[model samples]
Target: MQPVVHLAVGYLCYAAYTRLHHGREPADLPALVAVFAAGLADLIDKPLDAAGVVPVGRTIGHSLLFVIPLVLLVWIVASRRDRRLLGVAFAIGYLSHVATDIPWHVFSGDFDELGFLLWPVTEMPAYTGVKPLGTVAGIEITTLWLEAVILVAAVACWWMDGRPGVGLFRPSHRA
Candidate 1:
């Protein structure tokens, strides 16, 4: 899945969770936190892979192994901080990204490609295959169309939800 899709899905998940659990929309901080969480893995994975420090793009950050410790750590700290929902939002966003990727590879008939999900426990061969869209220097029509559809869906969903705004650049004054 692309970054925009991941972000949209993550935000949507958080919004749904909030609406169901709290009977209201999410606040700015948690919503932004979820969006950042969704794209966080890619921020780490892409850099390391491009630098040749990792054999595969989906190594550490994209693994269940990675999620376990981080989630536990966040849980402990957030519980102590009395911010448990923030932790849940983080996990939800992060896991949403992972979840989206799995079905994509599976649907694309790349079952063996999912071995990278195990990271260190599973040795991932260096991926020499052409990327879905190489870079901004060139564009792939298929990926462009897919991204366009996702962008529209994400915007539509957000709009339907009254456009929950996550004021990431502003401070939250919650008690």
Candidate 2:
């Protein structure tokens, strides 16, 4: 999925999860943080390769082994403060990104290519078939549908939130 779509989907997921579990929406700043953080793995991979470092793309960030521990560590350290909300928000976004990639991998007939989900336990060449790299124009119907869903969710969430402007950066003032 595209970076913007990942962010949109992450926002929708965090909003829905918080609303359902806590009977309240996540704060705007944390919600936005979650959206960006959701795509952090994909964003980090490219630079790692260019720097002559181990190709971490699709390997380290996408790994459940890595994500789970990272999220857990944040959750644990933030257990005493409101920062826990931020941790949960980040986790929601990160995990949702991982979940959304499954169908893309499967549709691309590269289900086995998702060794990154396993991380250190498995080693395989990270496939780039589903991503638009170079002249490849890697496009798929599943990805299109997912993007549409993200758009719709973003619009719906905006409407539900009263279409706030700067208010989106703050927690809801409502009880």
The CA lDDT of each predicted structure is 0.77, 0.73
User: On residues 3-108, what C-alpha lDDT tens digit does candidate 1 reach at each position?
Assistant: 7788988888888899899998777777877888889888889999899998778889888899778878887888899998888888888888888777655545
For residue 9, what is the lDDT in candidate 2? Answer: 77
| Clash tally, candidates in order | 0, 0
User: Model 2 TM-score?
Assistant: 0.76
Q: TM-scores of the models, in the given order?
A: 0.80, 0.76
Once fitted onto the true fold, the runs of candidate 2 whose alpha carbons sit more than 4 angstroms away are: 131-142, 162-175
lDDT string, candidate 2, 29-78, tens digits: 67766877788877776577567564556767778888888878777876
Query: In lDDT terms, which candidate is top?
Result: 1
Q: Candidate 2: worst 10 consecutive residues by lDDT?
A: 131-140
Candidate 1: give the clashing pairs: none
